[model samples]
Target: MLRIDGKKVYLVPFEEKHLVDPAYYAWLTDFEVVRYIGRDEYLKPIQFEKVREYVEELWRNRYCSFFAMHHSGDDAFIGTAKINYLNEAGFSTRTADIGIMIGDRGYWGKGMATDALFAICNYAFNDLSARKLTAGAVSANKAVIRAFQKIGFLEEGRLRKKLLISGEYMDHVLLGCFREELHPVI
Candidate 1:
């Protein structure tokens, strides 16, 4: 589990203990928020038992870093972030992929993603011994694309028709951030 504080928020691994939180599940399964998450969309709100089982499976996989984004004021679970897709092909152990979602629509556009990203970068470099991080954003998601840029991820390339959303193909923007390249004014 990775713990990050300050920036008025924190991120830690989501455990089975959190799955039973109805509020968390309700927020996550909210279609309004999940519209832009990934390759597939969840058809129905997940059952607590299913979510718990997923947490258990992920805990065992060790391929994903799923965190519960929390607000410091009340320690409330607001969203999530993940770092996965570790590549072992090269001699250098320097890069991984990142993904995040702010489940609480009420908390959107509040620098929550920025803060969470900074913490993730810190984890990548400090704890995971990584040198770089990568991510892909849907072409139409200006907020997310800009968020990645705000965190020092430069636009790398574009993949046309990479994803099908609502029966239409959408492009993807590949972006990256390097550990040695981040500059934090603290």
Candidate 2:
């Protein structure tokens, strides 16, 4: 099991047990939890079997890595993070996309996302030899955007009125960070 430790949290390979956990499923279906995820408007609540299959497939995909985030002090499962190569050519491009979701409501607003982002970014830059990392969030999700920015991510661009959430259009904020800009917390 791969594990990356940070000041407030640790990330381990997302596994079968995580997928089957009731909390995991609940987080996915909760509108409040995933409103910024930007799933197409026509999409319905996620199905269990489909998520299982997708996770299983991810396990074999060399270009993507998914991790389950846990609180370091109590070992509480709190969220998930992923690093995906931007091209099929893999490391040749030296670029990747990083995303994270803090699932447990109790962990929100406590810097858990920032800690996890630092750890994941360190892994991407050092372990994976990635030169640049990118991320995006719905403009209204200020917390997420701040977390990324706090970790040295710079605003890259924005897609104006690109996402429809709760019957309102919102901009999609794009961010990017070079390896040198990352401040590792792990």
lDDT of each: 0.75, 0.88
Error of 1 at 74 (Å): 2.5
Q: Which ten residues in a row have the lowest lDDT in candidate 2?
A: 37-46
lDDT, candidate 2, 1-186, per-residue tens: 689998999999998889998998888877777888765521467688877877787788888999999999999888899999946765688888898999899999999999999999999999988988999899999999989999899999999998888889999999999988887433
Residue 138 shift from truth in candidate 2, angstroms:
0.6
What C-alpha RMSD separates each model from the true structure?
Answer: 2.4, 2.0
Q: Residue 53 in candidate 2 has what lDDT?
A: 78
Model 1 lDDT per residue over 31-80, tens place: 77766777353545566677667667667655567778898787888887
For each candidate in turn, the TM-score is 0.87, 0.93
Which runs of model 2 end up more than 4 angstroms from their true locations? 41-43, 184-186
Q: Give me the displacement of residue 153 in model 1, in angstroms.
A: 0.4
TM-score of candidate 2 against the unseen true structure: 0.93
* Reference-based TM-score, model 1: 0.87
Candidate 2, position 138, lDDT: 96
